[model samples]
Target: MILEIAQLQVKPEQSADFEAAFAQAQRIIAAMPGYLGHELQRCVEQAGHYMLLVRWRTLDDHQVGFRQSAQYQEWRALLHHFYDPFPTVLHYEQVAL
Candidate 1:
């Protein structure tokens, strides 16, 4: 599985709106191909900061399948405006032990 992590920093007073938008946006992502699951977590010390974790079957599932789909436009419209400097998204894979 591929793990996608995004450190989201919203504008100071727009956290609530950001969360509300994300609630709507999540459905779009959840319906994409190869999507496994996702979670959004708020920072304890930073009110406008959040961590988004998403599991995909492969990196292409997120980068190409989702990002290239028309649904991405809706996702962007719903949640992109709340960002400040914009979030950096990275993908990871489990290390065998």
Candidate 2:
């Protein structure tokens, strides 16, 4: 499985709107192929910061299957505007240890 982590820093006054938009946007990602589950977490000290964790069956399932699909455009439209400088997303695999 692959784990996608995005560190999002939303615009200062737009956190509420961002969360509302994300509520709708989450459905789009959940419907994609190889999607397992996801979580959107807000930072306690940083008012406008959030972390998004998504689970997929493979890296391509997220990078190629989802990001390259039309649904990604919809996802981008719904949530991209709230980001401050854009988030950097990274993927990881579980370590046996």
Residue 62 shift from truth in candidate 2, angstroms:
0.3
The Cα local distance difference test for each model comes to 0.95, 0.97
Against the true structure, candidate 1 reaches a TM-score of 0.97
lDDT by residue (tens digit), candidate 1, 21-75: 9999999999999999999999999879999999999999999999999999999
lDDT (Cα, 0-100) at 46 in candidate 1: 86
Could you tell me which residue pairs clash in candidate 1? Answer: none
lDDT of model 2, residue 57: 99
Residue-level lDDT tens digits of model 2 in 17-80: 9999999999999999999999999999998999999999999999999999999999999999
Candidate 2: how large is its RMSD? 0.8
For each candidate in turn, the TM-score is 0.97, 0.97
